[model samples]
Every structure is written in C-alpha cells, then in structure tokens.
Target: MTWGDGDGFVTCELGHKHWGRYGAAGLLPYHDGYVLLQHRAKVTIGGGTWGAFGGARRRGEDPVAAALRETAEESTLDASEVTLRGLMHEDHGGWSYDTVIATAPALLEVRPASWESKGAAWVPVDEVAEHNLFEPFAKAWPRLRQALRRPVLVVDGANVMGSRADGWWRDRAGASARLRDQLGAVDRYTGIAPFDVAIPEKVLVVEGKARNIGPGDTDVRVVSAEADGDDKIVETAASIVAEGPDVLCLVVTADRELRRRCVAVGAEVTGPRWLLNQIAPKAVDTPG
Candidate 1:
C-alpha cells in the first residue's frame, strides 16, 4: 500500500534471514563479454564481497523497477543507457530474489555512487567465477551467465490471436487489444532456443482492423503493422538480429511461411503454446 514500506528483514521458508519484506531484486548489467559487479562495503552485509547492485523491493513495485531503482541508487550508470533483456528468479518458497539482466554495450562508464558499495568494475563473463563473490550470487552465476544476451520476442499477433477459438472472428480489434493487455503482465517462461529462461522485449505486430491498437507504456509494445502481421513480425525479428550475432531474436507464431522467414534471418521460432502457457491465466475468455 505504501511506497518502500518493504524495508527491514524477514525469514524465508528455509529459515534463512534476508532483507526486503516484499523480496529483493538486483540488476546484472552485461556488455560485450563483461558483466558489471558491485563490491560491498566493509560495513554492509557480507561486507568486502562482490555482487550485483540491488536491494529490497517497495510495497507496490515490480521486480524490474525495483532492480533498476536499486542499481541507480548504488551506481552512476544511467538507467536509460541499459536495455533490459529478461529476469532470472530464485524462489525460496514465499520470498524470492529476481535478478534483472540488461545490456549497455561495451565500454559504457559505470561508477560506485553509494557508500554501500566500496567499488565497482566490469568483470569478464568467463572470469566472474575467479573473483570472490557474494554467496547467493555465486550460486546463481552459472545459470545467469548463459542468459547474458538479451532477446527480442517479435509476435505474430493475428496468427497468435487466431490460435485461440474464443470468438475473435467477431471483433478482431477488440480481441487483439485483449491479447495485448494480457501479454503485458506475462513473466517467467523460457523465451526460445539457447535461453533456458527469459522474458524478452515483447513486440506485438498487429495489422488490418487491429492496427489501431497502437503504442503505450505497457509491458508489451503494440506495433500496428502497415501491411501483413506476419511480414512485420518477421521484419522485427530480422532487425533485432541485425543488432549483433549475440542478440537473440525469437518469433512466436505457428505460421509455416513466417516461421521459415524468421529462421532464414538467423532467428528462432516457437509456437503460440510457448506464450499461451505463461499468459493464459491473464487472457480472459471472449464473452458469449
């Protein structure tokens, strides 16, 4: 109810003590072959140790926001400079720590901005294990490192919308709008190939009558396609692939031609089930 009311400590189901009543989150900033890490001050918990910049979540804050805010508070890196890829969650029954992984390219400047951190540096991915790291972070590093590359999930809106036999045929625009809203709240779920778990930057490609469902500040970006939704989805995936070989581009659709086109451009493909399994609870049935 109140902002930052989640201050203080709480015990997890494991009987282990942890900070943050609403749970904690951290930002793992990766660039090129390196990941930015923070060293705890001698006066702080697990002092003189290295880990990602982060802290407790506020009462109403999402994990992503909490991660970004905490990193901003502890480091001089500009939040806008980073592009969040996805999150890796460590659940301890009721309480959990979500690590939001993002990228800012190579050689971006980052400095320690708070007393909680004694120092900051960019450590190579392969060398992260060589350094003395915080216990929890050390445990999660193996899985986190595999997801260093941020992915772009370009969706075939019409195709995905058509997959559900929920009366979308009657009102295409309204159905697309409903689908977009549900996608905004989706979490967890592995994105595509090479990424064991992730939440990609979602781009919903809508065309025809659904084209009017335009941009917003929601979790999903509505891209009203000028022509075919399938073409736009493939184009979006190609553009992301153009960013770099390391950048992941996954297209969500079962359309054979579209899937082939996306794969032709060095992108991965998955059916609607890949998304529906995660967002189905959020997608309300079309009223009869």
Candidate 2:
C-alpha cells in the first residue's frame, strides 16, 4: 500500500494503534429513516463489516472537510448533495475519530467508488444493529441515533437588535439587513443542548419597519411579522416543533413572555445574548 500523508499509524494514550497520524473522520449520511453504510473489502482491517466512509485527516484539514473528502473518495455521493447537520467526536486519549452527521434531501443512488469498499447500501435505522458493524462505529451508533434530529435556530430580530446599543433604533430596516447578512457568514453554530454540534436551519423574524427586509445571501429565512413580533416568534417556534418531535427548535429572545410561550410548545429558549455572542463576539455592552 502506498503511504501518503496521514497514512501511517500512531499509538494513542490508550495504547491502541490507529490509522492516521493526526486523526480520522467519517461521514454518516441519513435520510428518511435510512443511513448510508460502507461494506469493507476483505483486504481491509474490518473486512466484510459495515461502517461509515472515512479515513485519516490530512494536514491542517478540518474534521468535517476530511469526512466529506473521504466519503466522496469512497462513495458515489458528492458533498454538495448532503447538508451538514451536526458532529460527534470520540477521543481515544490523544487520538480521535470525528463523525460528521449529515442529511440527504433524498436517497440518491450510491455505491462503492473505491477498492477499499466491497459495496454500499442504504440500511434502515432500526436494522443497523443487526449487521456486523465496525467496532468503533457500533459503539458510537447509540448516541448518534439519538442525535439524528435536525436543529432550527429561530432569531428574534427585534429583541436581538434592541439588546444591542449599536444605533439599531435609528434605522431598524438597515439593522435587520445587517443582521441578516451577518448570519449568512456564520458557517456553524455550537449546539445549545441536546445537540453536540449544530448546523441549524436559521429563521429570522422581523416586524415594524424591518418587515421590508427579505432573504439574505445565507440560508437564513426572513419572516416578516404581520402583527406583533413576539406573537410571530412564538408561532414560528410552534410551527417548527409541529414538524416532528425530532426537530429541535431554539428561539433566541430576552422577552420572558415570549420565552414562556415558546417553551410551552416544546421549543428551547435562549436569551438574545447567546446569539450576540455568536454573530458579534467583539461587540460589547450586549444586554440580555
């Protein structure tokens, strides 16, 4: 076998030899209660067993990027076809393996693209445990299954902007537009709870003068309130939660009444400060 960068093995603090000099990462793509699993070739270590498509992380590579690259090299699906959802990390002392959880819009056709794989199949979630799985993957499956739910981040534009003393009151529409554009630049969000890492479906609610602002460059959906912003925020959270129990909603607002209303409908509530810290870490004087 040709030794490439991150190809060699290293012993972790746990005294186990593992592939990749830095660390390893894998992709777990799921859709409609099924997950894409790779069948290992007989020549590989876990021969004839099923696991995720993955390998060692390259120098200076992000874990998610490594996972996507390895998956593309070993499978027929491209990174563009899947949307990142969350991340789960397993650290074996100094060594580690990162699992990037993603969602496919639909179950597109997939098969083994490299010799390392014997085949590939979309296995049902419940039936996954019946197969002889790779040892590491098997151990991680339980937690991974629990985290399959997608995250929805609901932003209270009026509340969040009001909390900031950045002259938002002077130009409400301009401020909303700025916030929308800034949210577009954010690539990932650290999960609040019940989620390890979150790449959420962002929703921003605007009312009054800011209602004219539309969707920005990012995935953020701007919802213009017909009436009260607080009422719209609560409705949005309720609508999202109603999609499924697996859909996690986190509403950002400092309004106690709004928080109580959102929480009543199975949505998690956080203050505006939590969001300010994410979008504008440098901005000071942000009040909850």
Candidate 3:
C-alpha cells in the first residue's frame, strides 16, 4: 500500500506484539553539533522524556511528509528548513510506525506549543544521555549519535536522468556529463545545501557514457566502472558499512531494484525529487 493508504499497520514479532499503530517522523535539529529535543509533557504518553519532535502520520500522507508536517505544527519550525537524512527505524507489530530522521540547519529555539509536548530545547550530543528519554528513543540514541556524525548522499545518475524532463534522452551522454558537472559544482558550494554539520562525503555513481568521471577536489567523489553504476553504488555502500557503525549513507535512485540492494546493506534510499528539490541554482551555471 502507499504511505498513507489503508489503516497502515505492520506486525513486529519482537515480543508482546506491542501496538504503536502510527507512523512518525522525527526532526534531529542540529547546529554546531547540538541537537534539538523535546521533553514530553506530564500529560502525554511517554511524557517527561526526551525525544525528537514527531507524531502520528495523517491518512494519505507519507511518513516523512507527516513527520515534517507534525514538527512544524508542534514547534513552528518550517518544514523547508529541514533536510531529510534517512529512516532510523521501523517498529511494526500488530501496529506499525516508521521513524523518519531528518536534519535541521540550526539548533532552533523550539517551544512546546502543542498539547503533545511539555517542553523543548537544544541538547548536545554528548549530553543526550543525561535526559530522561522514551524507551525506544533511548534505545536508538546510540545509533543516532553515530549517524549524526556522518551524513552521505548517493546519486544514481542514470535513474535520475530518466526522472528529469529536461530532454535528456535526446542526448544521454551530454545530459549525464552536465549532471556530473552540476553535482561537482554543488559539492563545492559549501553554503548552498546548508547543513547543521559539515558533510563528510558525497558519492556519485555513473554508468555507460558517464563512466569516466573522476573525483574532484570538492566533497564529492565520482566512481565510474564497467559494472552497472547501481552495482558500484552497492559495493561502495558495503565498503562504507565495513568501516563500522558511525557512518550514515543514503542512496539516491528511482530504481526499485537498486533501492532493494542498497537497503540490504543498510543504506538509506530516496527518490530523485528529494535531490532535485534541494538543488541550488547557484551551484551550477547553465545556458539560459
């Protein structure tokens, strides 16, 4: 079923078959290494505990969309101010909930204006352990801590090319070449894609005519190979996974099969729109 269609519940056999019955999106607003967290109000479920700003998904909405919407409603933080990082978890059982973790550019001054939250404040990553946290959040904190340190964006040049209506098919090679150049330029525009923390890495995989592009001095590294770019992406992702648990890798592609492959190795997947929407005009110079 689609994100918001149906009752939206999945069964998790993790025991007791706990029923959360809701999908959620959490904003891990960060600025200069600090994260924004909320202290649940005494009246709310899991109240008086620390957690990211989030809530139940509305019917007919995607979990990520719902999460961003809830964050704005609860804290008055603009949804456009945040950049989706990836999914942190999916808790399902008789009931189901998807955790969409996004990053914000600053340690926003968030207040608990909504009935669901009692208080909200910015908390340093090192200090998160000091707060009384919701059980699930507490359990996920360690992993989140690691993820916050390294954020990655993977591009499937071919799939993205198909998604763009810019007349790319007429000149596949030229389109891919231009895309590579644009991405390279983007990597150098430090403030264009604004992030709470410095992005450690960006990987772009190109196939066919685009296979010869190489890494530049910018934050992006281009990998072109004889094998399918999708395979190369998965391989690179697997290599990153081997570096330990502190890395956050996101795969960008509209290919379903590629998405499944990335997920198998713990990489997060997002469609081309997510990337295109974030593209800044200042990053690339084009013919008018």
Which candidate comes out best when scored by TM-score? 2
Candidate 3 lowest-lDDT run of ten: 188-197
Runs of candidate 2 exceeding 4 Å displacement = 1-4, 286-288
- List pairs with backbone clashes in candidate 3: 11-93, 11-94, 12-92, 12-93, 40-48
lDDT values, one for every candidate: 0.83, 0.87, 0.66
Candidate 2 has what TM-score?
Answer: 0.93
lDDT of 1 by residue, 1-288 (tens): 123777788999998888889999999989888899999889877899999999999887898899999888988989888877778888897578989888885657788888888889999899999988998899989989878887877778898888887789999998888788777776555646444457677889999999988755478888888876677787788888998866888788998988899999999988887687777843434434
Q: Which pairs clash in the backbone of model 1?
A: none
Ranking by lDDT, best first?
A: 2, 1, 3
In model 1, state the lDDT of residue 127.
91
Give a tens-digit lDDT track for model 3, residues 90-159.
4544344545545666675567768778788888889999889977678778766755645667788888
Across 52-76, the per-residue lDDT of candidate 2 in tens digits comes to: 9999898778999899888888888
Q: Point out where model 3 deviates above 4 Å.
A: 1-12, 15-20, 153-172, 175-288
* TM-scores for candidates 1 onward, in order: 0.77, 0.93, 0.54
